[model samples]
Target chain A: MCTYATVHADMDGSAKGPGSEWFHVTAATVYFDHPVHAMAEHTLNIDLADAAKGPNGRVALELRADSARALIKAIQDALDSVPEELRV
Target chain B: MSEQLTARTIQITGANGDEIQAYLATPDETDEPGPRGAVLVIHHMPGYDRASKEIVRRFAELGYDAICPNLYWREAPGAAPDDAAAVARAQGGVPDERLLGDAAGAIAYLRALPTSNGKVGVIGYCSGGRQSVLVACNLDVDAAVDCYGAFVTGTPPEGSLRTNLVDQLPNLRAPLLGMFGKDDKYPSPEHVAELDDILTANGKPHDFHSYDDAGHAFFSVDRPSYRVAAANDGWAKIAAFYGEHLATTASTPTGA
Candidate 1:
């Protein structure tokens, strides 16, 4: 399983709305690079409010399904796999 | 002190049956004649009180209506209790959902009010600084000003006084103007740089200023953290930013 949080920021590339007035997110799509059964039941719960915090601060480490723990560890390890030179 | 708009306090329902007490102040232009703009002043986690209303009074002097909301609606009541317990209780309780929900309610309230010119904007300092950002993100506002507030970053510090504001940047939409002091311990220069990088990478329209002599919250001239020169400069720039954006909407002179 693969899953990480994402921020639904200004689509117009502006920190705020232009003529529209309010800034809001209609939907958010989470990313997970891991493999799960095609038919496996999966759900993701996210706090849209925390997306501004970036990686560690933005999202917490919890699972959505039966193997959530395993999924989180797998994704985190993949992130930790960067070579020192390629870490950039 | 200049003339101010008569303020009204009303109890409004928030997310999940929460009762939020909101303060609305508008420029009493009906008596003075001529129409001015309106400003939505979101208060910090400190909650609405005398200090917060005075801020609204200052905005009224600037020839605009200002409304402030008590975002701490869900927090346990009996504020302060005693003077000696102030420092301890300030750290007691503030849930993320509670504050955000209350702010959302406040935004709705401002939009429905008759006295408002409808060209609304939001600004806050410290905890309120980030709150302003959140309100701007989720609601429609002309402008947003964040002063020495929390910014989202890579790592979390252990002693962080606030957590939710740190994670809400991606939802941002309002044209943001951030003012920070080099000495602000919470948001160090590096933190500001990281935020700059992300915002620039995302191609967000943002302007950020940091002063070396000033540290965290130089806005309050009466406080210990206040710096005369930096505060004045930041204040003027903020005023200019609001004047450029919030003060003018579709109906105003240059708004068209």
Candidate 2:
């Protein structure tokens, strides 16, 4: 269906990008659309990127809907396990 | 049979006269007489990747000069195709006006070639499919092919950036060949039927074929959605349609 809906978030973090080099990530673009490599017809895709570093400066993931939801829960659980004071 | 052809990347004028990257393919010059028709291959929303380039070459092998403009060049120049697509998608995708402009540029480039027969056809897959119809309605194209394009007759989800071309259908200026999969949800059976009715009522020439056992992207060989039978038959339809509309005749004049 090539869903055109996309959600963008500004972020301050670092991730391993092309060439296995770590780059400061400035934004996250999330969408449920056709995947480049995934076997499924559609998947939840996330691209963590550093715009200033050009296109190659991206860390990408394509997960099934269920996998994406599970990942979200996992992230929330990991954050919750930290002390309130340590959460930031 | 494989035809001798040459393919390369070149820069062409796009929307606002911006120089953007494009892939161009043409059959090798031989003793073959008369100029050849041209085709504008619109890449899907996935951006101008290798598959899209291969499609352009396929048209060339079919003896048509073909070109595919990089729709994301303005946003992510020098970027890998997938990266460029991600960047473009985040930006709400390419605007309709900009798409029309870039298509016009590509068509112009094809027509300007010395070997062109001044006839141009357009073919697009996925999102490009809808754009193909949009371009046909707004431009002076000879033929158009829409391969399972969504939102051409159906409503997109709420807050989605996509829109249908119901109003534009009345202005369709070329013969259209639509290939769809009955199992596909987007542009489902009902939507395709609706489109068929509108074009019929409008007196627009259209040939639509819906495959029973296929779904969306049946023509995408690299994807799991690919349906060999549907894809092969769709290709045959495309070739026949273009042959009828784009073939050079003795009475036809060359040049843009």
Candidate 3:
């Protein structure tokens, strides 16, 4: 068994509609050949608010790492599926 | 026609008689004008032993006092022979905690510099990237940029690097922007989105941009995975974001 799973990863779009129109995360080119070189996992947290006459406010993220590589295919598939709009 | 930039250092006493050294880069005092803002740049696991001053030098070009502190100074030479060796030092060790704490102190130290305008920002790569968010979460600085940092996922959390960054994302008083590569193996897109979701949900003013074609450390020119296009775009975005949020404007009361 692959022992992996797939996720939206916001490739389809973080908040919806076209991919290009949404924010995107790139790939791990350094670890493809050696999945173990880049394996890691952690959760991200953010707080929303109103400021400077702006609708959105500050956001923060927390990450935790184990070794280097965790699951490869799941992350790759999400990248390949991102909408054309999100592609760099 | 580029003027010669100056390089200098400062000695900081960490615990256990360890003397921490920092690398500082300043624009030519001969320049016709002063800097726009001041920024402290932190390097990744490769240490100050790797990479160029040009990245931080570019900050000086933008008219800001720039400093890149080497957090690894506490270690003896040749300590981390490889990535794993460095990882061992970074995960759950006194050096790691002290380095991070020192980073916070560096922020304060810069804020006090005679050249400082009280407005400051921080930028980091890889481990340094993770630290940028961590520092901003715990401080009252102007802004921060986290480039392709490792993120957390799942209920229990998976990272053992021992950084509390992922958990503190919701508490940043200043706007933080994170850039990641979608194809990155360590920090998957799912994880990146989880971060975005948390920020959006909390009403935090943050934006995470993951380049579709780029990968981990894509901005790192010295690495094999460096993506020219992505790095260029990222640099522009970061600069603009800082200009909007951190830089001082004639109309704004104080520029951060």
Among these predictions, the greatest lDDT belongs to 2
Model 3 steric clash total: 48
Candidate 1: fraction of native contacts reproduced: 0.00
State the lDDT of candidate 2 residue by residue for B9-75, as single tens digits: 9999988999999999888887233488999999999999998998998888888899999999999
Model 3 CA lDDT for position B2: 22
Ranked by lDDT, the better of candidates 2 and 3 is 2
Q: Score residue B79 of candidate 3 by CA lDDT.
A: 33
Worst 10 residues of 2 chain B by lDDT: B27-36
* Candidate 2 local distance difference test against the native: 0.92
Measured against the true two-chain complex, the DockQ scores of the candidates, in the order shown, are: 0.01, 0.75, 0.02
- Candidate 1 residue runs with Cα over 4 Å from true position: A1-88, B30-36, B73-92, B158-168, B251-256
Per-residue C-alpha lDDT of model 1 across residues B51-97, encoded as one tens digit per residue: 56777776766666667766554342333212111122223434446
Q: How high is the lDDT of residue B32 in model 3?
A: 15
lDDT over C-alpha atoms for residue B15 of model 3: 36
lDDT of 3 at B97: 63
When 2 and 3 are scored with TM-score, the better candidate is 2
For each of the candidates, give the backbone clash count: 17, 0, 48
